[model samples]
Target: MLSAIREIGRLVVEQVINPAQSSGGKIITIVLDEANAALQEVGIEDFDPEKANRYLHTDRGSKGNAPAPFAPLTEAKKTLNKIRTWLSGCEKVIPKTAADCDLVNTINRALGLDDPILKAVDAAAGLLQKKDRKFLTVKLEGGKTFLGDYEVFRKAVAYFADRKAEKSCSTGCACSICGKIQEKVSARTLVYGFDTDDKPGFIAGGFDKTQNWRNIPVCSECRTFLTQGRKFIDSRLNFKFYGLNHCLIPQLLVGNADVLEDIINILSDSHKSVSLRHRIKRRLTDDENEILEFLSGSKDNMTLNFLFLQKSKSAERITLLIEDVFPSRIRAIFEARDHVDSVFSETYNFGKIRTFFSKSDPEKRSNDLNKYFLEIVDAVFRGKWIDFSFLTRFHMDVIRRGLVKDEYFAFRVGSVNLTV
Candidate 1:
């Protein structure tokens, strides 16, 4: 999944999708048009309402309660403080090269203001308060976000990419992703719900928190791609799966990135996905629309990866991973399901299978039995063997529970038939 994500990130960085546009969310952007002009003065009169644009800025990182590196705005004052701090850092780090001079001067002028860009931020916040908006961002009128700036991104990468040097380590360490020893590596796991930074015990080597970089060491390039890959996943591939959340990732088979790019485009567009499903006569359960429908008519050059995950706050727990499922296998799964439905002369699908495993509680939420049900799902998709006696045991349990008036007898019988 991490490798696939890195590939997606590579594609994103290669301009398959503009990283700036793709990383953005539903943000109320306060465009500081004429920054040079704004820096010349310090008053509300200098702020322009025309510069404000409300569009979707899908920064998934900020959607959670955790503080992101360049977090979106919750309060105007805090946003200004971040801006000030960022500018100060940029001034100190951005080289005086001809290529960087313009951005450096902009940062310098923005910070040089006696009142600075406070008025613009205050006015922008005031405008946001009048309407309902989930996030706020300040950008220059040239259409580049602060985080989207090339220099800012480069600085960020350098700061993180050279962590080995920062820690005063002269020797190279092995990177978990590429399996190579490198002088520079990062401790940050771009994918959340995987390895968390807060847990020291989760570290691979020792309990020394400062030396945690050795655990799942990722190189700078891989780390960058992971970041972009996560953005793509969060914004596009994440979907609902039988009352759970899953990420549908595509892995290339023929060494052709174009095929993977096509898959990405298809999944990202609803109309294309529906059209593909219809062309292939694919049937889907209600929850399966986002999961199986899009791959119905895809080529055999790539396989699909389904990662069912549970995320709470900052930690994520993977529920199940059904990997390397080829398009041919998907077709086989559906064909088998259809054949069963036809033989029974009744509706049969995964949804019905799920009911047999569903909790009898009032809310019918997930419980310990979910793992067993997921195992069944994994087995079905992978064409793995299931013990006949185990199925009989479960079926008998359902029947006996119904007979004892624990559940409706007819419903249990129907459920048993659907699975059998």
Candidate 2:
């Protein structure tokens, strides 16, 4: 799964860094110049995803003041403080003689507690909340935006990547990821929310914290790819299954990136349609828009990896991992599901099975039975065998509970049992 994430990173590295390639829409830019110390609201301009790169985003940290050059106007006061911090941080990184310093100075002079730019943001707060209007950049008249400077953008990228605990850079060391001996390898290559490597106990051989990089050494280039890949997975590939979260990662069987690209497009939001049964019955124009059908369409070129994640206030937990699921297996599951639906004369779905293990309030946290439910789901997807007795106990519990109240429980139980 980690290897597949690195591959995805390689695919999206360019798009993640280059604003023009990754994003579209207009930005409500604030222009500052010699004549305009209070700032001027220049009309919206095209969004450049590459321009934001590492400069504008706050992905590494959760705190409000986590050092970012630009911020979206989501919250007025918070955005102002972040912009102030970003300018201060930029001043420390950029040399006095650098061209970026002059642009930064122009922004510093114009911004204040009672600036016109704030008023502009307040007026456009509704528009600013929109997806395309998420980014707000400070630019000088006839000069580039603060994030548009390649030098400062590079610095921001390095800043976030090096925010790791390890500082001892290695030279001519073998990268644990790609297995290549590189001149420079970074210890901070791992993505956030995947694992907890803070404690020395988690380190290999329980060595010093600084030597943690030796456990999973990765080259700088590969690090960038992984970061971008993680972003892609978070934004596009991630989905909610029942009450749990899962990332649908496409892995190529033959090392063809095009196949990955095709899967991505097929699963994209623009290509998505109604539910599978509805689309099939209605005869939708784009039959391949449904996820199950498209996934089943690919027989040999690729497979899928489902990473089920549960997030809390502190960290994310991996509850289940169903890997290397072939298209044939997906087709088989759907075929069985269709047959069961036909026999029952009522629409049957995964939710019905999930309900047996659910609490009265499904939104509540999972209890002991939740693990069993996930295990059953995994077994169904992987075609793994489950002990008959082990399954019967849960079925018996459901039937016992239904006897108390649910009048139509017999039909519900029968449908789920046959479908499973």
Candidate 3:
């Protein structure tokens, strides 16, 4: 077994990583880490199945060596994978606290806030309230997005109130969400963040950037609010909020792939980077377009709205991700990944929401949520999924009831092509 473990690392190094002629630079790094870590954990102070198992002493006796080299590979591979999962988090490449702090200092200095910004943040006790954040917005403008740590948001109304923007308050202070303009705290105290994709206002389902603030961009107003709001907690972290820029177009496009070159180009904008994936696969294919032209016998008029998943619903998509990194095993990786609350993926977390009984409000501090709804009409049409082939009436009705009113599941009646 010990020798088998050794062989596992060797094979992985030789077959999976080293032998791959087209391996990317990023993949090579992961492979190296896995191999080194796996080899270190597997010790050779035990039986040498490759040499002579008889030379080794077990509880039973000196068992003869296994003849075949690859015989133990199956078990070896499985054990190696388990060991790798355990060790991956032990040596994370990314540091704790999510983003870099020095950048914030530089930005604050550049903003010409002087030290008063720091004093104001300390007055507001920013550090004390830093962890009190609820919802965050992953907003981007064209190719530029604002990914930063903001204690609070300065609503458009507030900016107008400060007369900072020098523009009329389209929405006045009285009608505003409380008189929070002076304090710079948004009435919508976000406990989490809005997983805004590329489009600024509209958030998609499934694909949300849950990366550190260094990965998400933030607008100037947000940073100012954070820089000032820290006074709510402590003055020290007034300049703590800083903006970051990231390009995740490659991973997104690969996972949510389509045949259209134009679409891909639009997504991977060399001119403008757009970081957002779709909820379903609705790319127009040549065959489908041909079918449409043939069926309608018209080419002049073709309208496709291209349905995008709602931000709330999209908060639940987790199917597509990059292949290179051990994204799941990274320390606090789950936090960076938009959370899932659907029954199907809820188990991915700590089984927190998997209760036998339903709750009136079972939401949590996470990005994705599966707001299940009851669908009596659809239940009647499709019946239910029972035996491999047949659908019994009793079983069908039982399944139908489950779909309806079950917050764990969501969907009415439509073909959803999700890339899992």
Find the candidate with the highest TM-score and give its number: 2
TM-score of each: 0.75, 0.80, 0.15
Q: Judged by lDDT, which candidate is best?
A: 2
lDDT of 3 at 333: 26
lDDT per residue, candidate 3, 3-80, as tens digits? 111222232233321111111110000111111111111111222222221111111111122221111122233322
Q: Which stretches of candidate 1 lie over 4 Å from their true place?
A: 17-71, 88-134, 139-174, 179-183, 197-201, 209-211, 277-280, 291-301, 363-368, 392-409
By the lDDT metric, which is better: model 2 or model 3?
2
lDDT ranking, best first: 2, 1, 3
> Could you tell me how far off, in angstroms, the CA of residue 11 lies in candidate 1 after the best superposition?
1.2
Full ranking by TM-score: 2, 1, 3
Cα lDDT tens digits, model 1, 357-378, are 6564425455546787788889
* Model 2 ranges off by over 4 Å: 14-28, 34-38, 42-55, 58-63, 95-103, 112-120, 123-135, 142-146, 165-169, 188-190, 205-207, 272-290, 338-348, 360-368
On the 0 to 100 scale, the lDDT of residue 95 in model 3 is 30
Per-residue lDDT over 1-420 for candidate 2, one digit per residue giving the tens place of the 0 to 100 score: 767777777756544221112445555566665443556564456666555543355456424455455555566556766766766767776666756776566566677644566767667655544556555556655344445455665675476556563364578899777778998775656575645567666666456666667777778777776777777777766666666667878888885677776566545434243443345542111222236555676866778888888777657778899999888988887787778778877666666666666553335575556687789888988998988777666666667767776556777577456645
lDDT of candidates 1 onward, in order:
0.62, 0.64, 0.23
